[model samples]
Target: MPPDPHADELRSPPEPFSSRRPTWDDVGRVADLLAAAERTRTGVVATRAEDVRVRWLMLDGLEDVVLVEEPGPEPVLVGVGEYSTELDLLDEATVVHVEGQVHPAATGRGIATHLLDLAETRARSAAAEEGAETAIVRTTVIDGDDRARAWFSTRGFVPVRHLLTMRLSLDEPPRPPTWPEGITTRRFRPGRDEVRAWTAHSAAFADVPTHFPLTLEEWVEDRILRDPAFDPSLTQLACDPDGEVVGLAFCRAGVEGAPEEGWVRDLGVVPAWRGRGLGMALLLDALGTFRTRGLTGAALDVDDVTIGPAVRLYERAGLRIVRRIDVVERLTSTG
Candidate 1:
């Protein structure tokens, strides 16, 4: 296909290394790039992909990052982006979440514009192959960080959602809760019967396409061993007296690249268990666990549109939205 002059201007003579599938060897390289980008003197924790998770697209490396040049050794890391994937129901949602920092040394060069062009082309190609017609992306800028926000607005993404990161001091008094009537909350130990529990947990998240699926064996064999942050004690589940796991609180602390940080992967209660305060119970339970671990702080991401009124629940439990992540979705015409 002949490239449009607009998109062509974004191209280099030709890419140095052709794109390919990522392997385990690429993990370290990707981590290195993230460290560099995140440590940009700006308080932004650039990004984090779990050590055990390298799926969707390995566009995490500098290879996926295009550097615009004009006869120089230190051309500049003008732009950085990732061609990642997530599931939208059964459809493959191809994504390109990018942020371009114009190199002060390379000002007046169309580096930022060119990088966007490159990203758009790559995103379009991937989306087309995956039967996606519409494009989607996201970017995060700190509060009062007008420069970055203005930059994205100029490129056509409206700030559709807002979020903040709320921190709870582990040193403070515990606000533990009494389990609701007939509901029993227990910490999940990856033991003999956990596979069945974990499998059912995966099924609960099946409606959320981006939430990766793991068999019980996969949970123990792959994730449990690969991630240093996987502490079974911090992870938890809530069940009815009937001996069925209906709600869960997935927790992890001391992420590999992110030190002194803890995350609430997710907290959910099955529809049948809704209104029983099960969600709050599971999360508050995790908080107590964190307090016990003598941890510093914890964070979690929540969709403002969640059906479970989760935003209010997290806020009530003292978790604040640290940052806002915009989710722009376009459905392909399967007709």
Candidate 2:
């Protein structure tokens, strides 16, 4: 029989690596891989095993994570992909945030592309499961990561937002916060303050881009009550003369990589209380609390859009932009 010219094309090519769902035992290795990739791309080692653990906990399960490795007796993790979904409070759209990382040594290969494809597939499936009328898939890269930006751009993603990580050195005492007239501050009470604090937070961030409202149960369980590092002394609430919560500062004593640096996880003032110095006061109080706790620095992330109020407020409180992450998204479905 004569050989057909297209026979070679019909044969499948061998895959270069193996992929599997990440297990809890893989947390440390996954963190190491992520840190290595970040260090190579951004010159920073910010990811820790604890961070990976927290993120995994937030996801439905480890099933949302995929790890690719070179096949061998000692397989090396060469790529990773993960996705999580949140429902937009206003429009009820499903926003799936996808993240992919390839080892620096594995660049120029198809590993990243494969991981991203898997992420998108997972996102679409999640959106379908949620019965979403609109599905958006989003990802982020460091501001200066042109290679990554180009990769995403080629894949139909467009830049949607920029987030800045601001840092403040607490080498000296922070200026005392002057209380706004008719406003007073107090420490956060875990059981007593959850509802009011959540209300204030939801109202304050309702206008912010990409902000989503969490149910009071979710707010208490996932954010404050379940967080092992939740320090009541570090968290504060601003109250009106009637003792209603109008603003809040939810802070963490230490984050994953920087033990001595406090993280201002969330700080906001309700719409009615804006421009009353309540936001600034809560920020200053957070910084003061961090300093009093022997923390050498404080950090927080805010939107970097033009003249953003949060950015301006943070800058006014002596926080300077240290890093920027560019968020990109693609509309996958308009069902």
Q: Which model scores highest in TM-score?
A: 2
Model 1 lDDT per residue over 79-114, tens place: 333444344443446665654444444434555555
The whole-model lDDT of each prediction reads 0.58, 0.81
Error of 1 at 96 (Å): 3.3
Error in Å for residue 264 of model 2:
1.9
Error of 2 at 19 (Å): 1.4
Candidate 2, residues 203-295, lDDT tens digits: the string is 988887667668999878877767898888888999998998999988998876688999998888888988889889999989998999999
Q: How do all models score by TM-score? A: 0.66, 0.81
Candidate 1 matches the true fold with a TM-score of 0.66
Query: Which ranges in model 2 have alpha carbons more than 4 Å from their true place?
Result: 1-14, 130-134, 190-203, 206-229, 241-244, 271-273, 304-307, 333-335
C-alpha-based local distance difference test score of model 1: 0.58
User: Residue 313 of candidate 2: its Cα lDDT?
Assistant: 84
Candidate 2 collision pairs: none
